[model samples]
Target: MSTRTSETTVTFGHPFRLAAIGDAQPAGTYRVVVDEEEILGLSFLAYRRTATTLETPAIAVRGGPHAFHRVDPADLEAALEADGKAPRSV
Candidate 1:
C-alpha cells in the first residue's frame, strides 16, 4: 500500500496559526503551522485560506474564513500511521 506524506517545520505555540487554502466554511486544502511543524489537512471552505494568518474581531467570528480543527499529537500520529507516511529517523 502506498502512502502520502507532507513536511512542515514550524513549531506551534499558544494561538498557533492554520492556513486554509480555499473556501469560507473550510472545504478544501489546509495547512497548520505550529512549532515549525506543519500539518496538512482538509477543510470545508474555499475562501478561508487565511483563517489562521491574521487577527479577527473577537465575538464577530464568521465560522472560519479558513481554519483547522486543532489536532493532538497522538491523533496526528494515528493519522500518519494509518497512511504509513510518518517521517523516518535519519
Candidate 2:
C-alpha cells in the first residue's frame, strides 16, 4: 500500500466554523492537507482519500504552534462556499 499527500491553500473572506474545529476561525488563508492511498489490484492507477486536515491559527498568524484538525471535506467546502471564496484550481 502506498500513500501520498497533497497540500493546498484556501482563503476565507469571513469567519468560519467547522465542527471538527470548535470555535469560529478568523478570516484568513489556511493550509489544507489531503492524504490519499493507492488502490491495489487495479489495472489503472488510482488513489482514494484517506484523510483531510486543516492547519489552525491561519497561515498569517505567528508565535503559536499550529495544530492540524481533521475535517470533513464536505464541511470545508460548505464553509468556503458560504464565505464566497470557493477553492480555486492551483
Candidate 3:
C-alpha cells in the first residue's frame, strides 16, 4: 500500500491547544500536514502548525459545503505512534 500525505494552509479562527506542542496556537495562517488512513471509519484531517512543530490528531470538524469528515482522537494517536512520533496525550 502507498501512503498519502497532504499539505495545506489554514487560519485558526479560534484558539486551540494541543499536547506536547507547547503554548496555545493563536489565530493565523498555518501549514498543516496529514497522512492518509482510515481510522475509526473517519478520514484523516491535517495537523495544525505550532510555533516549532506540528500538532496531530487534527480535530476534523468538516462542515460547510464540503464533504463531512472526522477522525477519532484515539485513531490519530495511533497514527502518530505508527509514524514513530510521540503520541499526543489522551
The candidate that achieves the highest TM-score relative to the unseen native structure: 2
Which stretches of model 1 miss by more than 4 angstroms? 1-30, 35-64, 87-90
Choose 1 or 2, whichever is better by lDDT: 2
Per-residue lDDT for 1-74 in model 3, tens only?
A: 33456665444455554454445545444444556643343376444322222433334533433222233445
Ranking by TM-score: 2, 3, 1
Worst 10 residues of 3 by lDDT: 49-58
lDDT of 1 by residue, 1-90 (tens): 223333342221222222321222212223433323233463532221122122222223457554344444444333334444554221
Give the local distance difference test score of model 3: 0.44
For each candidate in turn, the TM-score is: 0.29, 0.93, 0.36
Query: Candidate 2 lDDT (Cα, whole model)?
Result: 0.90
Q: Which regions in candidate 2 have their CA more than 4 angstroms from the true location? A: 87-90
lDDT of each: 0.32, 0.90, 0.44
> Which 10 residues in a row give candidate 2 its minimum summed lDDT?
81-90
**lDDT score for residue 66 of model 2:** 88
Preferred candidate (TM-score higher): 1 or 3: 3
- Per-residue lDDT of model 2, residues 21-88, tens digit only: 98999999999999999999999999999899999999999988889999999889889888987565
